[model samples]
Target: MPTEILMPALSPTMEEGTLAKWLVKEGDEVNSGDLLAEIETDKATMEFEAVDEGTIGKILVAEGSEAVKVNTPIALLLEEGESADVMDNDAEGTQTTSDPDPQPKEQDGSGDGKASPVTESDTPAPAAPRDDKGERIFASPLARRIAAEKGLDLAQITGSGPHGRIVKADVVDAKAADAPAPAAAPEPSADKAPAAAPAGPSADAVAAMYQGRDYEEMKLDGMRKTIAARLTEAKQTVPHFYLRRDIRLDALMKFRSQLNKQLEERGVKLSVNDFIIKACALALQSVPDANAVWAGDRILKLKPSDVAVAVAIEGGLFTPVLRDADMKSLSALSTEMKDLAGRARDRKLSPEEYQGGTFAISNLGMFGIENFDAVINPPHGAILAVGAGVKKPVVGTDGELTMATVMSVTLSVDHRVIDGALGAQLLEQIVQNLENPMVMLA
Candidate 1:
């Protein structure tokens, strides 16, 4: 007996998907748990897997075809000597009787038995060449699906993304394949001449011709809807202010270098961000008001110092909650943070991983960013942005001025929840804790 490979439901928000690329070819040996295809859903490109092992016999759905429903028979796997006859008998809204020999129709042709448009293009225009080597592409799933359904070639599109990667809006507004450029309409004829073909069709007629496609509106997945609601509420409701301070980090850098060298045998590689997280946690203890949330008609102060650290993911971003940060060791926080971030990018995080916090941190320093203000993670009075530490000059005691490593930290605060004094006091603690790692250990 042969096994069928169904189109997978890649994400909770995904009702339909486009076959981005097939990992296995027809007649290829497939193993259970092997990645089968890359599926483009509404949110992101996800890998679909095979659960049953066998020889892959056919590719039922072509790549770049859109709106393929979940569980649709997408491919088939066969035992030795098994035929691809099962699909042949049931294809194109037809079925055969038990005794009838099924004939398989070749699916190599387009609607009119013509070659596919993908292969027909000899060369793209100079200004619109497609990315043959799509190394840094970033198209949204919805856009890819829409492009596929309409046969709009993505390669021919000049991507408007930062690095020229094709994005969703580019596909939606793409003109039809081989569509003539919109020409200026000829003027209507005078009494001496015949009336010209109604100039540019009336506006209503043009609009009707280009009406949007019919689509079934689906409910947002738990993750997407939650992201939207939270970000919107945070931006609209929170009264945010920022305070920036630069720390001379010559000691901290030397300290980290020495600590890592000594602990190299101990297997703990402490990142600067890890030190910052620990510092913030300890700082929250001394100025507890900074580690609190603002609720309707009351302020809910928290203990134990729960911190939400922002993690950027494929679809928007989420924060992983590091519970009782003030109580955890630097190594423990480092380990947990790595686990939470790994699971977050893989979309395997539970609600608890993202929810609840007294303070938050977003670090773009490793990416070489010098300064940025972060949006407050809700319920948390402040979110901290950590920048790259650089070499600078600082005045030291004993009337000595010297070059030192320095880092800039920015705190975005919700004014209603935390006053300027409390915010400043907490910042001082954070600075001190980072400067002296031994203090954070206590």
Candidate 2:
């Protein structure tokens, strides 16, 4: 039988991706572990590998195709003893169907004591339906029944099930689209008509206004689109609260300078941001309850302080996480952060390198911005926005005045998981860690 090469889901949240390029063409012989194509997800461009050895019989999707759905066949493969002619629509009719339900695990008397393989007789009656165009549209019987009930066009909906087979969820979404809107009110006189509600201008209206403007219009790419969507969702759904504090960086500066001087031989120079990362990690340890994330229905308290640092890239920024940050040395954290940031700017970071962190740190100090509130990244309990350090006069504990370098930071807390008191405690620990820099090393 001819096998189909389906599009793969590169990331957990990826629904569709661009088929960036194909490494093999029709009639090319391929083996397992061979590079099949390059798929560009919203986060990164990943290389897809062949899982089965076969000859590329047909390429259904062309290169540069956007929104190619996961599990939709991108190509057809001719297995051993199969010819290219097997890809004909007539051959599809002879394809065998398997049972959708799981078979009872009957243990065989073999020494391995494994369950027997399901047989063809186990297949239930009524195979998948075909479209009027004489093409096989893989859909479950329930989905077809629901589409019939709602009079929905099954061909228009994209399937998210295994092998791109239409499922119940897809049918529900399609049915929702087919729902009719409420009838409009009867037209009234000019004086009686209600005034239009205030809202943002439409895309067409804005474009008309900027038609003669002296500016270049740039289109949003995949990364920018994802960032906009995620941020918008975060702001709309997550209840946020902000806490601000000013920390004296004199001790951290002196400690970093002395360490850098001794480590000059090893070429390991630490940055202030590196110290911030470590301090946040230790603070999470001191206040473990605050080291949590807001899952949809529950809060997840973390054990290790996995810290995500925001690194700005060309089109969008990447938050590469430093895993088990509390256990690593300051020098190790600095080195890892530098490598991750470098890869992020080059668009070469993997999804695992930039995803899943309990907390985040966004430092705009390099840009000379002073204390701004940052939006809480979803799933993270809070994010610390660090501002530039500047020399400011402060009243000393001995009733005297002195000049010290102070950095202002704002912690944006997700009220769903972190309360005001807990957030304040976490920020207080971070301040203490920064003030007494030697305790962090211990």
Candidate 3:
């Protein structure tokens, strides 16, 4: 039988993506782990790999196709001794090529009446699990892993994913029933439905408001759309509070100058932002209680100091994380950050490279922005908004006025994860590290 190769979800939040290019054509023989296509997701452009060895029977979706939904059949794979005729018969009279709709009839979201076309094989292709009645169970790989770990039966649980496939949310919700239920709210009456949050205005409505004005309407890309949705959700749902502090950077500037001179021959010049990253990473270790993220029902406190640094790209931004940043030296941190930022601008980073961090740093100091509050990225406990350094007059220890380099910073915190006191302590630790730059090496 011919197997359908579906469009993959490159990232967790990706529902659809642009099929930028295809490496294999019809009748091309592809082995497992071979590069198949380049998929442009909301975050980056990633290469898709073939999971099974087969001959490409047909290419359903064309290159440069945008807004193609995940799991929609993009190509057809023929097994050994199989020909193109098998695809038409196996797909139940569906067109083998040039058909915009390539999804099989069984996966039309009408419930699991028949088995999925993707069957189990020795290779690492997407395999369909079977129920007790021998009916095929459509589920994601992550969902299946979670179900196995929890000792749950797939047949007993209902799927709410695309095309009725089981996803991680469905598995987690199914496991919740085994535990004690929380307090329930009163159900709404039949006539009185719950009110939805206002989504500002429709495109038509907004255009009407600007009828007389001359403006070019730009379409939102995947990156822009994701940024708008996630930030909107973060502002509305997360209970955010701001904490501000001013740190004297005289000692840090002196230390940085000395280190740069010594490291000049090695081609390593550390920036103020590099010092800030090290300071924050060390601060998380010093105030471990503040290093956490808000799970739905609980909080997850992480042990390592994984820090995400925001890098602005052409359309949007990417926050590539530096794992175990506290263990790295300033020179190493500078090099890694430069590489991450460069790749981020080129949209070549993988999903794992830009995700999973307890905290983030958004530094607009280079642009000469004095100070501004930053929005907290979801699942992160906080984000530090750093401002430019300026010369300011301050009182010396002997009560004499002296000039020193000062930088302003604001910590946007999720109250659910870190309290006011804990956030303050974390900020204090950061300020201390910056003021006493030599202590960071110790």
Candidate 4:
């Protein structure tokens, strides 16, 4: 029997995507997860992978085809030893725009499920412990092969990684602490860090990265087209006003450091993003209007704090949701965030991973960004922007000057459902949570 690879819905709002480029040609043997093509969604150009093993029987939609619709068969997979009947079948059922409904491929909330390596349902039972890199190892990363040859117990040595994952740094650090170690690090180089923001790459520079290949471009696919239309509509129609604030982060930074020290053994390291998410969720409960979507003439208030975090992909972006952000623990949120982000980058996210957001957060702190305003992703009235925290001077209670970590945040509000006062009130509550460093727990 032949297999038909159908077009996947990249986002809930996505009706179609452009068949950006095909990686395999007819007669190319492919296994599950072999890169098949690149799809240009409004948010990004994602690589599509083969879901089942087969040989490419025929190519239906040539590269740069923009006239494709959802459920359209773009390629045919021929079984081994089977004559090319697959293409004939696909051509027989040539998808039509006239059909309003086609059975949609199973989609989860975060991304398209077509090219996934594995799903939660297929996840094998946990196997015996593997090394930090998930490979079998006789000795710890620190103990070295000498220790492995001597059958030394790495568990006896204290670890530096969460849950003792045993990174090489921990072993060397342990060695250095045990005995005054040789200086290995090079002296800091002058101009190591640039003072000014770097300029965005020009067309020439980006084109050079492709090794001088003249690449063909195509029209935006259904997802990108819809995204362009919707976001454009939002920016144009939605009355957007932003409130910016700088927050003292000394307490929050200390809280994270202290919490990581306690939880490292349990494999949990709290990130600042987790606290930000928690604070947003907690603040939403008190400021219910922020947790709402402007549905035509009325506001749809959400009962759950489903906070979506925008993740950047190759061409566009995807916002994988952190469902019930307020109900989850910091560790849980951290784990989920890692899983969601990893799967998102891999282009294996499900539809549910991208839906159900009462509020949204877009943080650029990891990139050392100081501050930025975010575009409001709709149905959600508010989106928060979080910036990096850096140590700075501050006045103490006793009239003494001290150093404190400070962060900047900006809240973009849809003015139709919110007033300046209401937006300010929500921002103030979020600030309180960050300042306290413990309100997140509540």
> Which prediction has the highest TM-score against the true structure?
3
Error of 2 at 368 (Å): 0.7
Instruction: List TM-score per model, in order.
Output: 0.52, 0.75, 0.80, 0.59
| Model 4 Cα shift for residue 234 (angstroms) | 2.3
Tens digits of per-residue lDDT for model 1, 1-442: 3444656655433445667788989989866457889876544566776554578887778877666655455677776787777545544343222111221111110111111122222211111122445322333233444565666666567766433545455776887676422222223123221122223477567567757967454545434544665566677789998889998776777778887897789688888888888889888988977778988788889988888888888656768889998899878888899998887787667545677788999999888898898888677899999998888888877679888778899999999999888899988889988877777766
TM for candidate 3 is 0.80
What is candidate 2's lDDT per residue for 1-442, written digit by digit as tens? 4555666767656656788999999999987567999998777788887655678988877899886655555777775677656555433433221111121111000011112233443222122344545455655444554665676666667766545766656777675445332122223224311112223688689889989889777876777777877787788789999999999999999999999999889989999999999999999999999999998889999999999999998888999999999999999999999999998887778889988999999999999998899998888999999999999999988989999999999999999999999999999999999999899899
Candidate 3, residue 109: lDDT: 22
Give the local distance difference test score of model 3: 0.80
Q: Candidate 4's residue-wise lDDT over 280-333, tens digit each?
A: 888888788767888888988888888899887655677999988888998999
Task: Write down the RMSD of all candidates, one decimal each.
Answer: 20.3, 14.0, 8.9, 21.3
Ranking by TM-score: 3, 2, 4, 1
Clashes of each: 1, 0, 0, 20
C-alpha local distance difference test of each model:
0.67, 0.76, 0.80, 0.67
Whichever of 2 and 4 has more lDDT, that candidate is: 2
How large an RMSD does model 4 have?
21.3
lDDT of 2 at 124: 20
Indicate the worst ten consecutive residues by lDDT in candidate 2. 104-113
Q: Residue 65 in model 2: shift from native, Å?
A: 2.9
In candidate 2, position 186 carries an lDDT of: 27
